[model samples]
Target chain A: MIKGSLTLDPKIIRQDFPIFQQAVAKPLVYLDSAATSQRPSKVIDAEMEYYQKYNSNVHRGVYRISVEATEAYERAREKVARFINARSPKEIIFVRSTTEAINLISQTWGRTNIQTGDNVLLTEMEHHSNIVPWMMLCKEKGASLRYLEVDDDGFLSLDQLDSSLDNRSKLLAFTHASNVLGTINPAKEMIRRAHDKGALVVLDSAQTTPHMTTDVRDLDCDFMAFSGHKMLGPTGIGILYAREEILDRMEPFLYGGDMIKEVHKDSARWNDLPWKFEAGTPNIAGAIGLGAAIDYINGLGIDQIRAHERAITSRALDMVQSIPGITVYGPKDPDKRAGLISFNIKGVHAHDTASILDTHNVCIRAGHHCAQPLMEKLGVPATTRASFYVYNNNEDIDMLIHGIEAVKGVFKL
Target chain B: MSEDLYKEIILDYYKNPRNYGTLENPDMKAMDTNPLCGDELEMQIKLGESDKIADIRFNGKGCAISMASASILTEMVQGKKIEDARQFNKEELLGAMGTPNLGPVRIKCALLPLKVLKLAIYSHLGKVLEGDDRNL
Candidate 1:
């Protein structure tokens, strides 16, 4: 037996999430955290407290509640900055989702910097959010988009990266951890290489920041985008962290409202670092909820969470590989991968497998997983993805294995 | 037993699909893809005399529901007239699947072949009305 490294007691952790208390078709084996994590009561209570106590807009209102609301919102920003280890809170710009964060970068930074014949390097394992924005930006700017190929084992080829990172490459946009494959790319080393090649790196940490400890300063990435919902927080809130200099240089993405210093009839000067990017009213409650989520994760300790997930993932991978005709994707070493596994049983469709698992109260994400390009590259239509989190334990993996066996039984394989 | 969405018939159709290939010099051919799942179906119908579907075939890749539905669709519309084939609705397709209570996502997979068939018929009608005989 592999030595267990889980420090957090999942039984106790599940108590913090009240969703388990409610009735369902069967016992919920939530293995879909990579899609969206279930929110804990702390995060839910934080948002509820915001609405119950001070539910006013931020920045403009000088009333007492407004001031308190603004303070809470900015405090959330500070919490996020500290969570990601950014130099200052001004580097953290709140957006709707990871998709919006990437879009903001593409529109502001990409529009300004990318030129005709410039290349934006993306990896094959990227979610549609990371790939689509760059594709649109490159098309609009007449710049070319290149991909860093993923090998058969679901790891990106460094040789392909080296060859692709020519002087014409302006930005290296890649996922820190793949949502489907669970392969954690070496962001620090890749960032260093891209910086040497005179290219800015945009780290799509939507799948990474929630699971592992992330330090933007240490990674030295020019920009990083991640969603709140994927990290046990509410949806409609995401963070985009850019260096101060880069934020100062790029134009504002959305126009109008609080993003401006003064709105003249003709042209107007923009607001300071973060506010200029955050136009209109933001997801106030979502941000505050994310702050509570950060605290929850911090209290549990991200290192311990990573270890716990690694243990679950390692066990799942081992047991899954033992099954006949099962093909598991991503790195074999548990340390190299995030807390998830993507696999397929031979002669069984991923949807069928997922349906059967769902009947067994095991929730695994199936379909192309918004990474059609990667699916095509993998030579499969789709694969079933089961992602783990702090609340998931060895029992969940055992349930999933049993669910897979049930699927085989149902299919008469 | 309660969760038998993958019935033996569905699996049989998926494993041994009927009329599962391309057609040469077809009268109508159209394709539609489920962008969410990357499921695609390309349908071809060779119209015989009196606008009857003399031969119908489908070629694509998708989940069991989609592929089986496509296979079943080819068998359903093979001898039907163009007008009758075009009139085939989602309920009839779902009925053929033997599972009317498909979940939201699977519904899309089950109806993809019907959508493609309707589009093929529409294209054929459009071409005939436009006085264009060349294959589309």
Candidate 2:
């Protein structure tokens, strides 16, 4: 069933990415999209066009080129808002990356709302970016930090959440998808539960926003953050989506030009919602490139992309599990996963597995995946991970399985 | 995949590993892991007079390249000076391996034992070996 959705002629998708054209020592079977996606021609061209034709500082200048740049930058924000079904461009604020976006929210909203003796709820699956900032805020505010435990398979246990939620829970920040485990959490339900407990929910959509359709309204999350680089756009730009009411409550994270309206020697009045959060000259080129990424994604359709990834993941899971010595991590059901899988083979360290795969010209991620807590929970120091994207196909999965088998054969395991 | 990448000599060492366990009377010890891939190594060295490596042993978990590399590394450095062993760089090691295409990951596996060796040797002898070029 998934095969039909993710099914495409690999030759066509291959055309869009120039890197695939290179005749490397081995086949470049890229399976690390969970880290950052490979860019298509459209995104590359969009950035090039901006630099070549309309290179100028935006928002401040009244000149034609600057006007064009400013318009392009704002238009990209509109595209981002639309991509996630956000209500308005005002809801979208660009930061350097998802880490920066999360930091902005935690420092601003967290400092203002969370009081001493209050609690901030997080999950064990959160990346350092999502977990550490909250930890910093909680430490400063004398607020306690609580955790929602994950199951043996690495899924967050709602039962743990049920027991943990309380009056003191002011903020519930968790990931929409586990970066290490690739487990897709039910954000809408999680949001509802948090709201019932009178706690605002923040979704770390860094992993999910790239692979699936993220309807912020449907999820009812107070804030959502994702990076542009992870979605085939350029690096150094990210998006933070907050509900208008929530945006009104937060303080500005950074204070500088463009974020302030009226400045006095002693006091300064901040600008409107989004601009207040985005201080200094923003990533205009990155924003335009992100817009092109949005267009590329839209052209393919996110649902279609999700379906394609599911297909690749299903095949990958089946193949990896079928191998006698392999120990698959995360949920067994492919439907519960997003676009990636993690596993280990008995007697094979993940790094070694990756090295053997590299000899085959297959690129995979091997490590804690920046989720040390999750790695501990999974009872492994590290695992080999193969994450997928829209351009990935069953052949890639086949290549991965073959690579693993070759590694096994080489080891005579 | 070329059979030369995982030569029989390397595989033989991995399967029938020498110095596979930690030293009983270790004069120096170090344990380190490649954070990127979770490959770990615990190396123990017994130093003779002049801080020569009287014997070396290792015990840990990793892939074929790492295990084989550890197996090869112990054999190469067991009777050498701690300082001389520290000077063994990637090129020298790769030259010893007879090829440079152990792949980066495997090379790291091969180097884990060496890194631990260097750290322990530096602390024990108060001398740094400058030959392990990490840039490769």
Candidate 3:
């Protein structure tokens, strides 16, 4: 745990988010942070400040406002680099979302590197963003895609890792933390094993980066991707961190505008490291907002945030376990998981359960959660998930429990 | 009590769905799945004389709204002419549920059975129009 000076108080923290103040028919118990987090006032204000003060295109313009805009944008890149403890800002490539980032890697890097008969190893718990791109890549390259099976407890089978890896394994792409199960995989160990087999690793950190301290250098992953919206920032902006050497060798995923140094008819020279990957007019205000979100998280401290979420998840597991006919998925130990719980009421469908909860304004996700394969493995059509963040507290969990009881009552279970 | 969407009737139907099974040598069978919620329903109908639905059954899994709607739909359309069953729409389904409104995300669940019923009837019509009278 990376400790910081700041302490978290959910009451005070909730004030930073304006959504909490909006009056509704019922009090809001938002437990859908795993889907997308609610943004704070500071993050919102940062974007407004950029547009209201100096809203100009970055990189190419020579005007004073453009320079300021460019400086703010570059500063946001630096903040993201520092947030993830990347060795250099050059490693940070901003894209639309984690989906686009993974697609970029699969198209540019995987296309050039992976050959026919090569293996792309993924886990059973991957989100569609992580799974679909690889499937496309493997199909195009005539390479086979393999999956490391997840057990009934939602933990990936590390025992099978040795056999799953071979010289033919070109890449190993897996999620750092599952969005549905909340099981935190041992990414560092997996990366080490993949490195021994000469396979590049892509860590899908969409769920991990927001809730925990992420140091790319410490994890030693070659490439990683996460969405800004999942971390209290604006939509339409995400980060893809790659090693400097690997990025230099990979081709650009998109063409035109700022990504090129010079364009002459049929041929063009690409721009420098990070900008080589970022094409056209970038999400300037979104990046600045993400920087402000990073500052906000830093103020609260990642260690404190993790501790607070762990406390909430521990209480939630304890309370939810006591509910009759309610079976929670993922690891039973709170420490082995992130701050989410996907579960099912024995006799009630997940959608019906979600609908009943909505009557009380308790927001949760109910579906296959974009992991349909995993849903089949779990033998459930869908599961209702309640994920927590820094702003959540015990009262929210209590409200959730009450809402669930109401579901049982309404269904006469 | 306060405008509850899942009323007693809906829950009752969900718990004990009517005409829930697979039909043997059914005249027409069709399946549809709600991609968003992973709700799936398969409808089978046996056409009797005068193109009436002699027997109907549905088998699959879904939410209370979808399951209850399927049960109610199977019961409503049984013994009805195929053309009349084809005219069933969202208003009638919602009215049967005793709720005038379904939130946007859930409306698909409420209407999946209707979609399956329409597809099954259309398929049966196509088969009949094509003059494939072996089973008819």
Candidate 4:
């Protein structure tokens, strides 16, 4: 691992991303990093190097280059495990995406452990990825699905979780941070409480992994999942961190060639922890890119990135609140959030607001953010979301504010 | 990316919508949602004995394009037949908006009202217009 304390002066970070160097449609104000992050040259070049110099199928080849390729692939897995502070590289299962990773855990663990009378505890602020799988699992198993509600500021009510964490609770899954509200849940505490009730906990870190330093070992959750695309890596690659013992107890998600020790006409023996979860040819380039992304994030440091986002979010909260008729959602304190901000303007539709912002070359997400239950709690069908990343700066926030002002002017509301 | 598409008239309708409230004893009612943006529109139609639309009312939340499109569409289809009203789709709305290159997002916004209108037609008349989904 590279040794360095984090320091983020936005000017220096912007140099790493080539997308910021060009002229933009409006002014290239990108605030949708929570959905997906912009890749740095280092991550891009890493993928290119793999295809250009060391292109081979890993684990099955005996040639010199194949060995090198296999080493790199395993090293990537190790890096992923290190990034999340998992106990072992074997615990890190590479899947197509966070959605797929959650589906894997749900199909394997949910199908096996959770019974008809069991309960799976989820949160209202969970993205559709985390909620839908458990819902499907509960429906199929004749189990009950429970949700932890949030306060008006989108704060997860841990006190409310006290009554819900009962003997029937077999699985507890939730997001580390909300994609829309940016509310960072008390993941460690939640994990502890769920464990107290003898339930497995899965943390969806798709929003948290990019902006915060994560140590799954310290969190001590049963499983955690995050997408590569949301952390400056290529799409179609994600990591599923399952505790080794838990994985050993769980069944394989898919059945195919690479995932089997030996196959008979009627039955097959599953290979191992990580491979059993990954059953296909896999996104080879994407894994390499994700490894490079871990390198990039580690180089910059997640603490520095988090600090930078805090500064920017503070500025954004001030700016958006300063505007009359503007209403901000989520917690008021920056420390309570990750790197996203959602808001609404009186008498303005979120799509209209987003369209006007797009005219100014500002990119923000405007919709339910796949958290329909949270949207209902917020009392709006949709809201404009401005998510930040390492590449974002004060100027980007200013541009977002300017874009909102322009929208207000055009609408004159 | 087209600010011109969100004309003053559109915002006027959004701020002080024409048919803001519900209708009493409505003849036809339809609700449509732009799943992408989460905009929901519930439109109610009042038809005359002559098989022509006498009045139209809508209640929902959406962007300027959808709100404006709904405002303009209700006006356009007030005295027209269900078939003729179905003909007024995104192309006519874009022509009304006077934009050359409208993106899919804006197109979605513009087509929200039309979708509700179509749903109303389908529910009332039992026939979905051809190629309505592809209009955007």
Give the 10-residue window scoring lowest on summed lDDT in candidate 3 chain A.
Answer: A1-10
Candidate 4, position B49, lDDT: 61
Q: Give the TM-score of candidate 4.
A: 0.95
> How accurate locally, in lDDT, is each candidate?
0.89, 0.84, 0.91, 0.85
Model 2 iRMS (Å) reads 3.1
Error of 1 at B136 (Å): 22
**How well does model 1 score by local distance difference test?**
0.89
Clashes (backbone N, CA, C under 3 Å), per candidate, total 0, 1, 0, 0
Worst 10 residues of 1 chain A by lDDT: A1-10
lDDT, candidate 4, at A357: 85
Model 1 CAPRI quality: acceptable
User: Which stretches of model 1 miss by more than 4 angstroms?
Assistant: A1-5, B127-136
Q: After superposition, how far is residue A65 of candidate 1 from its true place, in Å?
A: 1.0
The segments of candidate 3 whose C-alpha lies over 4 angstroms from its true place after superposition are: A1-7, B1-3, B127-136
Better of 1 and 3 by lDDT: 3
TM-score for candidate 2, please give it.
0.90
Put the candidates in lDDT order, highest first.
Answer: 3, 1, 4, 2
Tens-digit lDDT string for candidate 1 (A234-291)? 9999999999999998999999898999987898999998999988998999999999
Going through the candidates in order, their DockQ values are 0.49, 0.45, 0.49, 0.81
